[model samples]
Target: MSDVIRASAAPKPVGTYPHARRVGDLLFLSGIGPRDPATNAIPGNEYFADGRVRSYDITTQTQAVFANVRAVLEASGACWEDLVDVTVYLTDMARDFKAYNAVWAEYFPDIDTAPCRTTLGITALPTPIAIELKCTAVVRADNRQD
Candidate 1:
């Protein structure tokens, strides 16, 4: 059975899925949006407060998505250092690529240990969120539950 782990710092999933899942040495994270837990807001997706959905800007949304990813990794007793792979899906790939890479570089400052990654342009996402990030990481040795 897989052990489900939820990151306290990340916004709660709006659907039926854990923030992450630990199976043996690996953790698989679900696609995450730029939702803020404190505000219960998704800036560029469906707006909760105004009841008006807004389109996402590349930079802000990308950073927030990565932040959510980091929160999940930390909550799962792992970190970017443990990440082995990442998959990014975007609605506007050509225009958003630069902004996405900039924030991505900030997150993985050590380019030498970069995880394998796949970035693709999709026609649409669940919401208007510009970007979604999902990852795979190794459970750190000291924090291994099993």
Candidate 2:
């Protein structure tokens, strides 16, 4: 049976959806951004008077997003190493890819063990955050009896 999962430590989803879902041995996470759960504020981002993003630090957002992804994984009885694939969305690829890649390497250090990833440059997102991550991971049966 499949299960839906929500993580209290992660930011609340903007729409009507759980933080993640599990089916068999695989867990799928909704697109996760760098917004703090307690404050709903996007880290490293500054907004203009009109609410548009004035500037952002890709390194900060990347770190925060990774932490958010980790929260959902733990809530689903999985862990960082279980992540098998990741899809990253960036609003500005040309200017931010290097910083983002640096942060990614900090987390995934070894290429052989790192989850396969595909990054895309998108025009915009629902929020003003510059980056978002969609991830899928394996759930080891040993950590859960569900």
Candidate 3:
């Protein structure tokens, strides 16, 4: 059976979607952004008068996005080590890649055990955040038919 999952600890999804869905042994996460869960504020971000983003700290966004993904995994009875794949989106690759990658290194630490990852540059996200993550993990061991 498949189960839809929502994480109260993660930022609420901007649109109509659950945080993740469990299909048998796999947990598929939605695009997780860096919005603060309680305040809904974008960290390390400055806005223009019209609410457009003026400046953002990619390092902060990257760190928060990873935390958001972790929250979803934990909510779905999974763990960080259970991650098998990740897709990263960045608004500006050339400017942000180094900082983002550095924070990623801190989180993963070991290349051999890290999840397989692919990163892409995109024009924009729905919000003013600079980074977002979509992930898939092996939740088979905790497969208790949620």
The digit string of per-residue lDDT tens for model 1 on 1-146 reads: 78998888998887999999999889999988887868866654545577656455778888788888889988888886898999999888888898888878887778689998899999888766788888999997897755
- Residue 146, candidate 2: C-alpha displacement in angstroms: 1.7
Model 3 lDDT, residue 106, Cα: 96
Note the residue pairs that clash in candidate 3.
none
lDDT of 3 by residue, 1-146 (tens): 88999999999999999999999888999999999999999999998999877899999888888888999998999999999999999999999999999999999999999999999999999988889999999996644445
Off by over 4 Å in 1: 44-55
Per-residue CA lDDT of candidate 2, range 105-143, in tens? Answer: 989999999999999999998998989999999999897
Candidate 3 local Cα displacement, residue 105, angstroms: 0.7
TM-score pick, better of 2 and 3: 2
lDDT of 3: 0.92
TM-score of each: 0.86, 0.97, 0.94
Better of 1 and 2 by TM-score: 2
- Candidate with more favorable, higher lDDT: 2 or 3: 2
Q: Between prediction 1 and prediction 3, which has the larger lDDT?
A: 3
